[model samples]
Target: MADIGAAIATRMDVLPITRTHRRATVAVGLGLFFEFYEVFLAGVLSSVLVKEFALSKAALPPLLASTFVGMFLGALLLGRLADRFGRRGAFLLNLGFYSVFSLLGAFSPNAVMLLVTRFFAGLGLGAEPPLADTYLTDLLPARHRGRFIALAYTLAFCGVPVVGFLAKGITEGKILGIPGWRWMFVLGALGAVVVFALRRGLPESPRWLQAVGRTEEADRVVAAFEAEAGITEQKPAAAAPVNEPAVPPRALLRPPYRRRTGMMVVFHLLQTFGYYGFGTLVPLVLTAKGYPVSQSLLFTAVTYLGYPLGSALSLPVVERFERKFLVIGTGLAMAVFGIAFGYSGSMALVLVFGFLYTATSNVFSNAFHIYQAEIFPTSVRSTAASGTYSLSRLATAAMPFVLVPLLEGAGPNWLFVTVAAAMVVVAVDVAALGPRTTGRALEAVNTDGAPVTAPERAPRQ
Candidate 1:
C-alpha cells in the first residue's frame, strides 16, 4: 500500500498541468493576494493611520509590530494543525480568521482596538502562506513545482499595485462617513471572504492523505485527478524505505533535518529585517525626504510596478534556475537595490531603486517560499515550514521598533546599509547550506539523495 501510494502521488505530479491544478492554484493564490494586499496596507495607510488615530510616532510602531506578533503565534501554534488535520481545513480556518478580524479592524473606534484586530488578523496571515505553499507543493510535480508556485505568488504580488492604486485614489475620503483607511480594510476583507468561499471545494492533498495511511482515499483523489486529465496511472516500482513512525515535531531537531531547520532559522530571521524593515518603512522614508503624503503615495504606487512584473518574468525560468542559486542571487540583488534606494536623492532614483528592489525581492520571495516547504517531508511539511516561517514573523514583529529608531538616528542610507548587510548574511547562509531541489523528485528531495517512498504509519489521532 505504501509503495502504490507513493507511485500514485508521483503520478499526480508528473501528469500534464490540468485545469484542476490551475483552478486550485488560482484559489490558493487569491487567498495570498488578499493577504499581501492587506499586509501592504501598512505602507498604503501610513499617513492615514497617523492622522486618523492621532497617533504619536511612538504609538505607531507598536501598532505596526502587533500584527507580526500575532503572525508569530499563528505560525508557531497553528502550523502543525495542517499536518495533523488537513491542508484544506487548515487553510479555510486561517483564511476565515484573517478575513473576519480584518473586517473587525475596520470598525475599530481607536488605534488600540485597531491594533488588537490587526494582531488577530496577523495570526491568520502568518499561518496561511507557508501552509498554502505546502498545499501547492504537495499537489505539483517536481518539474513544474517551482514555476506554478512562482506564478501563483505572482498573482499575489499583483495586489501590491492594487493596494497602492486604491490607497492613492482614496487618500482623502469619507466613504459611508468612515475614513479611507477603514474602507481599505473593508475592501481587503471582502476580497478574502470571496476567496474563502471559492476555496471550499478544493480537494485535500493526495500525498497528505497517503502519508496518513488512508490509501483508499488517496487513490480516490488521484483517480479524480486522472479522470480530469484523461490519463492512466503507470505501474509503480518496488517499495522504498521511509521512517514509519509519525515522529514528533521534535524529530525535526534530530540529525538529518536539524541542519535544514537551522539553515531556515538563520535565513528567515535575518531576511525579515531586510524585507519587511525596508518595505514597510518605504512610505515613511519618502515622507522624511520631504514629499507630501499625496506625492509619497503616488511614488510608492509607481515603485510597486516591479512586484508583479518581476514575479511574472521569473516564471519561464523558475524550473530552469536552481532554486538555491536563485535564492542566493535574488537575495544579493535585493541588498544592492535596497542600498541604492536608501541613497536616492531624487524621486526618480527612489522610484528606480524601489522598483528594482521590489522585483528582485519578489524573485527571492517566490524562490524561498517554495524552497522552505520543499525541504521537509509530508508528515511535517507545513509544521516545519510554519515553524521556521515564524522566525520572519517574529523578526518583522520587531522590525518597526528596530528600524524606525535607526532611520531616525542614522538616516535612510545607513538604515539601508543595515538592511543590505542582513541580506548579505542570508545569501551566504543559502549558498552554504540550502538544499538543491530543482527538477528533483519529491521523494529524492525528502531523503536528500536517497530513494523517496511513503512510509507506513499508524493512524494519527
Candidate 2:
C-alpha cells in the first residue's frame, strides 16, 4: 500500500500543468484568502477599537489575544482532521466553522463578547493555512511545486492589503450605519462562505487515500487528473502491496523525525515574535510612537502592499534555490529591515523600511510553508505541521501581553529590536538544522533520499 502511495505520487509529479491543477490551486487559495483576512483584521480593528469603544490599557490585551488563543487550540487539536478524515472534508469543515463565529463577532455589543466570538472563529481559522499547505503540496508536481504554492499564496495574501486599506478608509467611520470594524468582519465571513461553497468541488488527496489503503479511490482521482492533463501514457503496474507500518501520533517525537521536529518547534516559537509580532502590531507600534490613529492605519495599509507583491515576486524564483536557504536569508533581511523601520522617524523612511520588511517577510513565509509541508510524510503531514504551527499561535496569542508593555515602557525602537533578535535566532535555527527541499518529491524528502518500500508480509494461513 505504501509503494502504491509512492507510485501515485510519481504519477502526480509527472502530469503536465492543466486547468485541473489551476482549479485546485484556486479552490484552495480562496480559503487562504479569507483566512488571512480574518487573521490580520485583528490588527487593523484593534487600532480602532481602542478609540471607538474607549478601551483602556487593561482591556485591550484580551481583545487582541482572543482570536490567537483560539487558533492555538484549533491548530493543536483540530489539524489532524486532514490526516484522519481527508483534505476535502477538512477544508469545508474549517471554513464553515470559522465564518459563523466571525459573523457573530461582528455583532458583539462589547469588547469582551467580541473577543469571545473571535476566539471561536480562531479555532477554525487556525487550521486553514496548514490545511492549504498540505493539500497543495500533495496535489502539485515536484518540478513546479514551490512556484504554485507561492502563486496560491500570492492570491491569498491580497487579503492583507485589502484589510489594511479597508480599515484605513472606513475603520474610523461607518458603512450603512454599521461600524467599519464590524463591516470588516462581515466582509471576511462572507468571503469565507463563498470559498466554502467552492471548495466542495475539490477532490480528495490521492496521496492520502493511497496511504490509508483506499487504492481504488486514489486510482480514480489520479486517473481523472491524468485525463484532465491529456496524458495518454501510463506507468507500469505497481507490484503487490505490503501492509504499511502504522505511523503513531507520537512518531514525530522519535529519531529521524525528532531532530526535524525540534528544529521546527524552536523555529516556530521564536519566529512568531518576528512574523505576527510586527505584522499584527504595526498599527499599535506606530500609534505608540506618537502617530495619530489615522496616520498609523495609512502606514499599515501601504506597508501591507508588500505581502502580495512579495508572493508574486517569489513565483519566478521559488523553485530556483534551496528553500531552507531562502528561509535563512529572508529571516536575516527581516531583522535588518525591522530594526530600520523602528529607527526611522520620517514618514518616507518608515514606509520604505516597513515595506521592505513586509515584503521579505512574505517571501520568508512562502519558503518556510513550502519547506515544512514537503519535509513530513503524508501519513502525518497535517498533524506534524499543525502541531508545530500551534506553538507559533500560542506565542502570537501571548504577544500582546508581552509586546504591549515592551512598547509602552521601552518604546518602538527596543520593541522592533526585540523582533530583530528573534529573527536572528530563527536564521540560526534553520541554518544549523533545516534540510533542502526545493524541487524534491515529498516522499523522497521525508525518507532521506528515496521512497521507502517495506517488504510484503505473507498472508495469514
Candidate 3:
C-alpha cells in the first residue's frame, strides 16, 4: 500500500484553491488580526495610560517588556506543543488563552495589573504567529503558497490600521462609559472568540495527521476536501516515503539546518529592534516633537493607512519575486525610510517617511513570515520556527528597555540610527545566507525528502 506522506503531497500539492481553503486561510487570519491589533495597541495604550495615570518612564518599559517576557516564554516552551499536539487544537488553545486574558486586562486596577494581564495574554500571542505560519505552510499548495500566504497576512495586517481607527474612536468617545484603552482589549477579546468558533470547522492538516500515525484520518481529510471541490481522487505521488523521522530541536543545529537556523535567529533579533522599536514609539515620537495629542494620533492613524495597502501591493508580486530577495529589498527600504523619519523635523517629512517605513516593512513582513516557516520539514517545523521566532519577541521585549533610554538620552535621530543599523545587519545576513525558496516544494527546499516539484501543466485526476 502507498504511504501517507505521498498521499498528502499528491492531495495537497496540486489541488486547486477551493472555497474551504479560502475559508481556512481567512479563519486563521482573522484570529491573527486581533493578535496584531493587540500588539499595536501597546503604542496607543501607552499614550492613554501615560496621560490618564501619569505612567513613569521606568514603569513604561517594564509594562511594555512584560508582554514579550510572557511571549518569549510561550514561544520557547510552546514551540513543541503544536508539534506534539495537533495544529488545529494547539492554535485554538493559543487563541482561547489570549482571548480570555485580553478581556481580563480591561478590568485591571493599575498598570501593574495591566502589565500582568498583558503578559499573560502575550503568552498566546507569541506562540500564535509561528503556529499559524507553520500550519499554513504545511497545508498550503506549494505552487500557489506565496500568493495565498501573502493574502492571509494582508488580511491579518489590515488589523493594524483597523486598530488604529478603533483607538482613535475610543479616545474620542467612550462606549458604555468605559475608557477607550480598555475597550481596545475588549474588542480584541471578542473578535478572537468569534474567530475560534469559525475555525472549529477547519480540517486538521493531512501531513500532521500522517506524522502522528493517523494516516487513515489524513486520508479522510484529503478525501473530504476533494469531495467538496469535486476533484477526483488521484494516485499518490510515487516518490518520497510516507513519513520522515522527527528531529529533536537541538538536531536542527547539527548540519544543513544549522546555517538556516542561525540566519533566522539573527534575522529575528535584528529586525525586531528595528520594527517594534519604531512601531511602539510612534505616539511617543510625535509627542516628543511637541505635536498636540489629537494631532499626533491623527497623524499616527494617517501613517498607519499604509499597513494594509502595502500588503495588498505586495500581493500581485509575492509569487513573482524570490522571497529572500523580496525580504532583503523591502527590509533595506524600511531602514532607509525609518532613518529618514527619525531625522525629519517637519510634520510633512515625518508622515511621508513613516508611511514609507510602514508600507515597506509590511511587504517585508509578509514575505519573511512565509519564508521562515517554509525552510523546515514537517516533523520539527513548528519547534524550529517558533524557537527561532521567539528570539524576535524577546528582542522586541527588550526594545522598549533599549529604545526608551536611547530616545531620552540621545534623541530620535540616534535612536533610529540604532534601529536602522540593526535592520541593515538583518538585510545583509539574509542576502548573504538566505536560501532560494521561490517556486520550490517545501520538501525539495529543505533537502529531507524526495523532490516533488509541480509540473508546469496542472495534473488531471
Candidate 4:
C-alpha cells in the first residue's frame, strides 16, 4: 500500500512536457528573443544609425544609456507589479507594451526621439526575462527543471546570432528601397504579432496562483496540465514544507530569503558586468584590433556560436554538480579564457579563446539561471529574480559608457584582466557564501523546510 501510494504520488508530480507547455515555452522564448535583439542590435547597427542621423560618438552614450535607464525602472517597478498581478496578466501587458513601442521606435525622426522610444520599449522588455524564468521553472518537475531552463536559454541565445545575421544582411542589402537598419525595427515590430499569438495559449503558473491564495485557479491549471499529460489525480506526495509565508515581495526580504537575495544580487552584478562587457563590446574590440567592420562582425558571429552549444551541453551536467561550485568554477574559467582572448594577437588564437570564453560563460549562466529561480518560493520568486537580475542589467547598462572608456584607456588586455579579476572575486564569494541547490525542489531552498541560512563568505585569497 505504501509503495502504491508512492507510485501514485510520483505520477501526480511528474507532469510531462505537454503540447501546451511546449507552445508556451516557444512563445516565451520568442518574446525573449525580441528583448535581447533590441539590446544586442545596437552594437551591430550603431555605425549605420550614426551615419543615417549624422550622430557623433558623443551622442551615442546617452542614447544607449537611455534604454538602460528604462530597463532599470521597468524591472524594479514591473517586477513588483508581476508579483501583485498574475504572471499571465503581467506577461501579456509587458508584451503588448514593448511590441507597440518598438514599432513606434521604427518611425523615430531623429536620435533623441529614437532614444526615448527605445527607453520605453526597454521598460516593457525588462519584465519578461525574469518572469519567464519563474513561470517555466514552476511548470517543470524538479528533476527536469535545470534542463528546461537550459533549453529555454538555448533558444533565447539564438537571438544573438540572428540579430547579427539580420543586421549584416539588412544593413548591406536594401529591401523595398528602405535601408537595412530601418528593416531591423520593422522585424522587431513583427515580433509583437508572435507574442500575441503565443499568449493566447499559454497558461498562468499554477504555483503562482496558489501562492496568491487562488488555490482553485491553481488546481484548474494543474488539472489542465495533468489531462494534457494523461495523468489521473492523486494526493500530492509529502515533501518537506517550505517556511516562506505566502506573501509577495515582503516574503523575499524575510529571514532565509533575505540572505539568498543579498547573495544573488552580488553574484549577478559581477557576472553581468563580465558578460555584457565582452558581449556588447566584442565588435569594438575587434575593430580596435584593426579588423574591418565586416571581419569584426564575422568574428562576433563565430564567437557566439559557442553560446547555445555550451548551454545545450550544460543541461545534463546541471543536475550533477553542486550549483554553487559549478557557477564559481565556470566563472573562473570564463575569466581565464577572457584574458587569453584579449592578449592573443593571432586571429586563430583569438577565435579559440573567444569560443572558450563564450562556452564557459554560458555554462556559468545556465547554472545560475536555474539556481536563482530555485532559491525562492513561488510567492516571491519572480520578484527576487527580477530584482537581482535588474542589478545585472543596470551594471550592463553602464558597461558601454563607463567600462568601454576604461577598456580604451587601459587597453583590451587590461580590460580582460579586470574582468578576470572580477570573476575571481565573484567566484570566491559565491563558493564561500552560496548554498547548494541542485536536485532540490523549489520549496526545499526556501525557509519552509530548513530555515535558510547564509553560507560563510569566502576567505580572501
* Best candidate, lDDT: 2
> Rank order by lDDT, top first?
2, 1, 3, 4
- Give the residue spans of candidate 4 off by over 4 A: 1-12, 235-244, 448-461
Residue-level lDDT of model 3, residues 1-461, one tens digit each, is: 23456556557766777788898889888877887897888886677787666887888888888888888888876778888887888888888888999999999988889999999999987878888888888888887888888888889888988877777777766778877788888888999899989989898888777777688898888778777767774654545433345566777888878999999999999998777777778888888888987888888888888888888888888788899999999988888898899889999998899998998888998899899998887878888889999999999888888888888888888888888898889999999888878777776777655454642323445
Better of 1 and 4 by lDDT: 1
Question: Tens digits of per-residue lDDT for model 1 on 1-461?
Answer: 76676676666655667787898899988988987886788767878889988999899899988888999999987788999998999889888899899999989999989999999999887887898889999898667788999988999999989888888997688787877778888888888889989889999998888888887898898878777776654443344433323456888999788989999999999999777777788888998889999998888888888889988878977788888999999999888999899989988898989999998888888988889998888889999999999989899978888998988888988999999999999999988877788876666777645654332221111
Q: Considering lDDT, which of the candidate structures 1 and 3 is the better prediction for this target?
A: 1
Question: lDDT per prediction?
Answer: 0.84, 0.85, 0.82, 0.75
Residues 1-461 of candidate 4: C-alpha lDDT, one tens digit per residue: 32332232233235656787677777777777787787777777766677789988778777766767778778887777777887788788777878787888888999989999888988888877888788777776666677777777888777877877777666876888867777788788787668777786787777776666676677777777777776664444444233344555775666767778878888877887677778777887887787888788788878877777877778788878787888988999999999999998978987999988988888888888888888777777788888988888788777778767877688889889888888988888787667777766555566454523222111111
- In model 4, which range of ten residues has the least summed lDDT? 452-461
Q: Model 2 lDDT vs. the true structure?
A: 0.85
Please provide TM-scores, in order, for all candidate models, with all chains considered together. Answer: 0.95, 0.95, 0.95, 0.91
Q: Give the distance in Å from residue 221's predicted Cα in candidate 2 to where it truly belongs.
A: 0.4
